[model samples]
Target chain A: MKILQVEGLTKVYGKGDAQVKALDNVSFSVEKGEFIAVVGASGSGKSTLMHLIGGVDRPTTGKVQVDGKDIFTMNESNLAIFRRRNIGLIYQFYNLIPTLTAEENISLPYLLDRRRPNPEKLLEILGLLALTDRRTHLPGQLSGGQQQRVSIGRALINDPAVILADEPTGNLDSRKSRSIMELFKMFNRQYNQTLLIITHDEKIALQADRILTLEDGRILRDEAVRA
Target chain B: MWLSKRALETLSQNIRRIVDGESVDLLDNREGPLSILRNDIQTLVRMKQEQADALRHDKERLKDSLSDISHQLKTPLTSMMVMADLLETAPPEKHAELVRNLQTGLTRTQWLTDALLKMAKLDADAVAFNVRKADAREIVARALEPLNILLEMKGQDVRTAGEAELTCDVRWTAEALGNVIKNASEHSPAGKPILIACGENPIAAWISVTDSGEGLKPGQIARLFRRFQGDGTAGYGIGLPLAQTILRGQNGDIEVDGSGLPPHVAELTDEEYSGATFTLKLYR
Candidate 1:
């Protein structure tokens, strides 16, 4: 099933002559469990595209349909709740709460919704990320890689319909980068989760089932990679 | 009744001793039924002591690890916050530099987080390796392919030789070699040719990447694979360690030869090359 559909997604910053078209009328659809890599040079609107799809930022002129529901059409409060429940976002800097322990951070989404975290799923994710031992450690008390894994754990806690990652491994070394990719691939297969990752590394992009090349705020090429 | 009362008193005394953390000599208590009871209590006490000791040790180790993590995270985080603050207060022209510094700080923190995660997974033996037999040449090609852009940008040349089929996890092995190749290429001088050679022995197959870069100092060689031990200019010092973990997972190993000589330089004249060589080997 098409889990996400972007229609005429246009994101413009500023106005008039000083305006910047971050994403220019880009449209695409992603199937459930599909792994797609978005590649482009810096300032090519790759992040803008991700933000739009993730519903973190509104597009000036476009519609983002996730699970056949137009997320952008919702009010800000509803959109925030929808994003919290349905879109798992990972970033280059991890974006974890420094004061929260790994376990608390992973359970943040559930807490924000005033829902109890599933203990079984929490244990499973902690084991999957190999973070069982660091569960009590705050972000300040964890390594950069560990903190990122916690953020990843947080993203997975909600079991969102789609995951949007922007240069998730850009700050990692090649080994860690590969491991993070492995984790993503594992989740993509195990949970049948949809993934849209923005990356500059060709090797990482090639790991995706499909590659989307962006240039000047437009998808220049969309091609499937041979297994 | 009198004998039973005396036995109960003796047993209660021993239990009290055990509870007080005092050593009870079970062998000294030689009565028939009391002897058995004492022996069981002795075993329980010993087990409890061992468990306590193990728990204490684990707690200490965890404390140390947490301290290290805190140190690693704080450096970048502090820099980022300071830079962000400066950017807020500084002149417009200084904003760019401050923002750049902030970015660098953020990048460092992110790298540290990733490295720690991988380290934890490897330590926990939680990572699953998908091993398969594959062509050694193909793996090298895959590893080197991603690096072609970097090599070309640096005006570097690469030469490969001696292909051999080997049993390995193709994807992971490629990643390991890619890290080695990236390290070599980064340290190598511009326009210098990086040589990759593959060969097989009776028990194992190996590939070596040699680069025309300044060989490691003797001190650096000892701590080369040590996590977070680099000069901070090249990288966060996690790549090589992570590669080592990946290779070891597949019964493979990596060796560094910092003698300032390529392994294949024997075929050419002595003046032809001077650099470092890293060799990766996988058991057959």
Candidate 2:
């Protein structure tokens, strides 16, 4: 099943003289459980593309259908609710609450939705990330890798329909990066989570099922790594 | 007294079923000591079922391995028999060629048996790996050393880059890497360079060989490392499985990715296909 369909997405930042085309009519569809890597250098619109799909920023001229629902067509409040319920976003910087414990940080999504996270699922996610022992520790006390793992747990707490990660491992050393990648692989293989990661690193991109190269606000090439 | 006797009788039957490696479903939803006993019995039954399933899976795998190994040996054996039969009535002019053919066949058969025997030993936990800290660079060099003659003959080039210090059974790791490099060379076209690179992520010290040949098909990945499974025509098919066995013995693994990389990863202007990469990793 195709879970995501991006059609004729074009995002222009400003008016005539300072007009910047961040994304230029990009179109692609992602299947329900694909692990896709979007690669490009800086200013390649990869981030813009992610923001648009995440419904954080609406496209200037196009649509994004996620799980048969056109996310862009929804009103702002509807999109916010839709994104919170379906989209899990992880960032390069951990973006965790400074004073919140790892467990508390992971429970933020549920807290925002005015619902409590299932205790069993929260424990399982923590254990999967090997963060059970450090669940009580604040983000300030955790290492870079541990912080990222917590962020991953937060993303996964809702069992979101799709995971949108941008430069997830950019802040960590190679060793930490490998461990994080293994975590991603385990989720992909075991749970069949639909994941789309944007990275500039070719080595990291190689682990994904397919690679979409972005250049100058346009998709240069899209190729399967393991069809 | 009658109810207690019946309960004991049912419990005995469940124990017997478990002893026979059969699944037992005990129906006791009552909230009492009897229910607790039933809960424990249910857990045991689940464990027994899992064990039986695992044993069946193992047996199936063993059967497949045996069949594959026999097939590998049979090919060379059939060729050897035909050549021997020709030797008996061959003219003098063809005698040297026929003898050489027999020698080649014998050597190939010998190598196959030798590799299989080593694998069997590894599987049996007989070989004590002498682990030590070794330079990834030296290991790559050692792996490529024996391939020099064969690669030169095949008109292939190898490019080695990057380095990391890895703690492994240096000699055996070199042996395992050599197998992967050899597989890569076999698939690569003439004049194309096989790329070998090594580096470390915090969790692992690694080496990878990317061949500039046809990559793996979608279904091929599942069986790519099994015994006697190779890209049908090129190899006797022992190398990858053996490499996996060796690395796994040392707390490591091998990953093969032939996903169509653009021109840069394994590009030669003349070739239309991207090469697959086999990475040998030893975790830190």
Candidate 3:
């Protein structure tokens, strides 16, 4: 299914003199479970494009729809609920709640809803993260590698239709970076999770199922990675 | 009189070198008596200051490490002793009980060591921040890979959308995303779905991880960014804070969105789930 659609999205900042065209007539569509990598120079408006699609910010012009609903049309309150219920976001930083343990961080989405946490399943996640022993530890206590795993757990906790990550491995070492990439590949293949990431590392970018190159607020190239 | 005259000349030359901002080689062996005296004195003073500074920094570091180590060891040691005490008193027929106690103790010790290691690394500046550009989805996938089996076992599925390419630290972000996703997958009900999505706006791009588990309390959300502070039963309190650090370090943020009538698993289609949603907002 076509999970997300963007049409004629244009975002402009400031007025005539100080005006900057961050996104100029950008449009794209994503299927339900495709891995996408967006590669761009420092100021290509690639980040802007991501913000518009995720409803973090509204576009100066154009339409954005997730699962066929126009996100722009939703009110602020509705958008908040919709975003929480529909999207999974990840960052270079783990963003796991520092005060929350690994398990609590993963379960936060559910906790926000006042629902009972599923115990057995949480154990399984801890096992997968090799965090069973570290479950009670704080984020400040875990290694960069382990902390990132907890963040991933938090993202997966919600199981949204789309997974978006920005510079996910920007702070780890090369070995850890490769390990993380391997994990992403494993999830994409095993769970068929649709992933969209923004990065500048060539090695990381080439690992994606699809690559979109951006420069100066435009799509420079789009290609599919060979299996 | 001749010796005094030579000493005065040497002192004046040494002072001139110091004022000129030139490095004076103490061993230059300038036979001039005054130059030799001044060089010797200057070298001795410089060496003494260097030693003093080194000693000071080292002492400070040692003191901090000792305190941190003691603090770190306290909880684990206490837990271990309690568990051990319980096991020692348990009846011989309670084999399962003994085993449980031992396991809990071991787990606590392990947790303490892991925390200490990270703390040490951070303190020593052992963690390197090598930023770069790469695919955000690739990072997410990498983060999610280890959690695949967990999701499948829980009878839950994780999904993603769009091309998620970004410029930042791949290792850091992947770790962050992985932690968040893993948390959601673990807490939410089995057979439920967790969704991950990415898209762009004019100012920045966003990657969101949403789960269909219980939502957060208003009080918890207010202080969610603080360290080691979860009201939930299973929280280690490190995951979200680490994630926040990683994000903030990269000029990004992790925000929680809990609106009226928190969405539930029942409300989510195979398309949506009732869990937490975390957004990683990236700027240009």
Candidate 4:
């Protein structure tokens, strides 16, 4: 089944004299549980595509359907709720609140939605992230790897329709980066999680099941690593 | 204005570009015979591009293997030379162990060369596989014939379950399966039983080997089949690539399922399999 679809996706920036087409008629559908890596050089519109898909930003002309619901059609508040409930976003910089402990940071999503995370699932996430002992430690007090783990925990706390990460391990050392990738891979396999990672790192991209090469806002190639 | 009714000159130029080995960015609107003609032309260009890519890939692989083969051979050769010097100078009493060391080095070199040569043949399309329907048990038994001593040395165990009669080049299939089994044995803890299961599904007949070690780490599965591209966590060999080639030559392939949690493990855990499971799928 198709989990996400981008149809005639186009994004334009600035106006007439300084205008640039960030994305150009891009269209693709992601199957359920697919782990895809979008790779491209800088200014390839990778971030624009991701932002549009995450529903954080709207395209100038396009349609994004998340699990069959057209996100652009929804109002801003409804879109925010839908995004929080269905889309999980992870960034290169560990986006944890300074005052929030590891546990609190992970629980932020739930707090925002006026919901309570299941205690058992929370415990499982902490334990899985190897942050059981560091649960109360603030992001500032933890190492880069630990901080990233907390972010991962936050992403999974909701069990969203799909997980979208941009340069997720680009901030860590090789060893730490590998451990983070392992966590992502593990979740993908056990739960059949739908994952889309935007990375400039070829090694990281190769780990995915398919690679989509974007150049100048266009999908240059779509290759299956394992079909 | 109909989308497909674009100027005749533009369509001719686009078709001309495809014929001249250039990729034409396809617009998302087309219908009828014009679409079919355009598609076929695009396919031809794609295939041409793919063939060129395949050629470059093969060249890169050749370079990698050349370096790998030399590196592998140099170790034993250098060691043997050192041993030869020690034997000439050392007394006869020490000469015994010296000779034994030299012999070991020779055996390793021989094995490495032999395997590399076989792989080269596979690469060159020199090996003509004899495809036939064969007993799964018989092939499994044959594959294990050479590994018995290694397994016995480590006190390892093998358990066979289920069975399937698959169409394949039995000896080559056995050879390929054996290499995979060998890898599993290396990963598995000593005395742990490696389960071999054979069965046929609607798509293909398969023989799967499940080892008792922690499954592959992140990023390992993708490179597992590449020649000499071992997962950094474990020492792998050219055997996997060879197995892959042999199977592919006969319309078969190898797949690995390294989901950390085993099938029965419902809870969250990072344990990869009981270990990793490798399955050799032979198309029916």
Ranking by DockQ: 2, 4, 3, 1
**For model 4, what is the error of residue A113's alpha carbon versus the real structure, in angstroms, after optimal superposition?**
48
Backbone clashes in model 2, listed as residue pairs:
A175-B201, A175-B202, A175-B203, A225-B259
Model 4 TM-score relative to the real fold: 0.56
lDDT string, candidate 4, A102-206, tens digits: 998998877874557899999988987888999999899999989999998999887676899999999998657756876776677555678999999876776
- The TM-scores, one per candidate, come to 0.47, 0.58, 0.45, 0.56
Best by TM-score: 2
lDDT of 1 by residue, B9-28 (tens): 88788789879977565433
Arrange candidates by lDDT, descending.
Answer: 2, 4, 1, 3
Runs in model 4 with CA error above 4 Å?
A1-227, B1-28, B231-236, B259-273
Tens-place lDDT digits, model 3, residues B58-153: 688668666656765686678767767777787888868768777876886686576556545544557776778777677887888878888889
lDDT (Cα, tens digit) per residue for candidate 1, span A173-199: 876786687677667756666789999
Tens-place lDDT per residue, model 2, B208-281, is 88888878763466466756656687776689889988988887877777555332223323433368878787
In model 1, the clashing pairs are: A143-B113, A144-B112, A144-B113, A144-B114, A145-B112, A145-B113, A145-B114, A146-B113
| Best-performing candidate as measured by DockQ | 2
Model 4 steric clash pairs: B213-B275, B215-B272, B260-B272
When sorted by TM-score, best at the front, the candidate numbers are 2, 4, 1, 3
| lDDT at B144, model 1 | 82
Q: Per-residue alpha-carbon lDDT of model 3 for A70-186, expressed as tens digits?
A: 888877765665665567777888787778887888887667655535788778667656689999998999999888888877776655667788888988986677567656654
Instruction: Identify the runs in model 1 with alpha carbons over 4 angstroms from their true place.
Output: B1-284
